[model samples]
Target: MELYGQVLLIAMPIFLVAVLAEMWYGRWRGKDTYRTMDMISSMSSGVTNVTKDVLGLSISLLTYTWMVDHLAVFDIKATIWTYLIAFFVLDFQGYWVHRIAHQINFFWNKHAIHHSSEDFNLACALRQSISSFVNLFTFFLLPAAVLGVPAQVISIVAPLHLFAQFWYHTQHIDRMGFLEKILVTPSHHRVHHAINPEYLDRNHSQIFIFWDKLFGTFQEELRDVPPVYGITRPSNTWNPVKINFQHLWLLAKDAWRTQNTRDKFRIWFMPTGWRPADVADTYPVEKIDDLYGYVKYESKSSGALKVWSWIQFGITLLFLMYFFGHLGTIKVPGIFLYGGFIFLTVYAYTELMDHNPNALGWEILKNAFGSYLLFSTGDWFGLNHYFPQGLYLIAGYFVLSTLVTAWFVRKGITPDNFVTQATKSQSYSTLNTH
Candidate 1:
């Protein structure tokens, strides 16, 4: 975990720089693809995901080392060729996992957050899953294990393979002539992210384009149809934690509500968006039908609220950097405490972004928890040694955050405001369709 923290210290900056550069380039090109709330929500989702990862909060059902020991047919040496083979095998595994996530009902809960964004941009690429606690699909790497690939090699190559997918999640680049045929470019990913009928569930490959072609899931971008991004059921709120489990919550409700025992048990495995017929008829969910005519999810916010949200995101990011830097020093329970604070901070501000009436209460809870940490640790997690006045700044920040949130609540800042033209023009689109 500490080693991964160090790796992220290097990687986090590069990612932020790339996202900011994309925003700047888009503005200069007269095609900015970022909204302040959406971008902040995306980055907040990233923080939660990395925090989950850095703390080693998951368990693998099957270990790769065990597979290598028992299933090996041939011992392969660690060479350039071994790494190449591992890369291909990993991409092959990713393709199947991606396809299954879009095709299965229960599995889709962990993946819905990635497709929740209404606009496709580099920042949106940061949106990842935190609800996945079990590594149930590690068996997908059986081919690598059977060939005697080392566990250490898989660990090293897995991160690189994941990072390679980030560059293609952009809109600034057009189709690369030959690379389009060989690699998953921006154009290919746009189709994958789109909700359009022609594009839905099309490109499931991560790094290589050939997996889709070989598996017969490839769909070329058509000249006449512009891609419409987001899920068929829009996540109208900005809270990443809520978005992660929305589908699971629905499934649980359906399981309890259904009278048919068979339907109750089969709903989870049936398919994405499936529901029991009785439940579907009794409790219908709204889904986007007229894809071109729907109003994209937007909440009314003034300039001041937007600026304050950015400030909150920036401060939380700094807190994350500190936590990552001192993971070894912070140790077990303390590290968990720090992580809890990070999660609460995200939940607090994002609720405010949604204009939720209970946001003030959440902000109060966040500040109370942060104050307890500060008073108990007596130095904001050993920061006084590094900087003499750091604790004072932290204490002041909690107070200011509470006051600001209270002020917004007192002023009656609600999502029901008439400022957003889309909110005024149309009601929010329906939820579950299938």
Candidate 2:
């Protein structure tokens, strides 16, 4: 956990910088693919996911170490062949796991968060899952286990593999001549994230492009079919935690509503968007079926609301970093307490972003809880030990945040959708690189 925290401390800044740079580049080129609240929602999702992973909030059905211990046929040294073979096996494992996640109703919830955003950008890449409490993909690494691969090799390679997927989740990058054919480029990933019928469930490979080619799921970004990104049934909310379990909740409701017991058991294993027959006819759900009629999920937001959202995002991020840096020093139940606080912070601000009228109340409660926790714990994760005025600074932030939120509520500040506003002002050509 400490090592992961350290990794976050180092990598978070770099990721933020990259997102900012991409934003600048897009603005300069006149494509501007990011919406402010959407970006905040995405980053908030990242925080929740990392906190879940850092706190070790997941269970594995079959341990990888056990697989390697019992299934090995030959002991292989860490040679070029070993590393090369490991990469291939991991890629293969990633492909199948990703395919399954998109194909099954029960598993889609674990991955739906990644497709929740309408706009595509580096910031949207941070939309990750936190409610996925099981690591069922470990069973896919059987080839590595059969080859006597060390758990250490798999551990080192796993993160590198995951991080490599981040860069390709952008609109700033155009097609690379030869690399497009060999790697999962930004163009390919845009298709993977699209809701367009031609692009749905296509290109499931992680690093190498051949997995999709071999498995028959690859689809090139065609000139005629410009991809419209996001899920068919929009989440329509900014809270990542809510978005994470939205699909599962729907499935659960369907399971209960169905008359047949067989339908209840079979609904989970059915195709990704499958619904029970009676429920489908009686309680029809809205679903997007055409790319030409795409309308993004959005809420009204004024300039002040956007600015306040950014401030809250910055505060939440700073406290998250503090929690990461001091993970070891904090004693029992402290880490869990920190995690709860982070979740509340994300939930409150996102509710505000979603334009919920009760958002002010949640924000007030969050600040009240924060103040009580600080007064009781005596510091912000032990910050008062080094900085004498740490408590005062945090107290000041809470006071200031509450005041700003209250001011917005009192002023009756109504907001307009950023994406709709931008689309009315700018035109994106289909022939353009983006």
In terms of TM-score, the best-performing candidate is 1
CA lDDT of 368 in candidate 1?
A: 97
Instruction: List, residue by residue over 56-79, the lDDT tens digit for candidate 2.
Output: 999899988999999999888787
Candidate 1 lDDT tens digits, 326-386 = 9999999999999999999999999988888788999999999999999986898889989
With a 3 Å backbone cut-off (N, CA, C), the pairs that clash in candidate 2 are: 301-415
TM-score of each: 0.96, 0.94
Q: What TM-score quantifies how close candidate 1 is to the native fold?
A: 0.96
Q: Which 10-residue window in model 2 sums to the lowest lDDT?
A: 417-426
lDDT value, candidate 2, whole model: 0.85
Candidate with maximal lDDT: 1
Clashing pairs in 1: 286-430, 286-431, 287-430
Give me the runs in candidate 1 sitting further than 4 Å from their true place: 418-434
Error of 2 at 253 (Å): 0.8
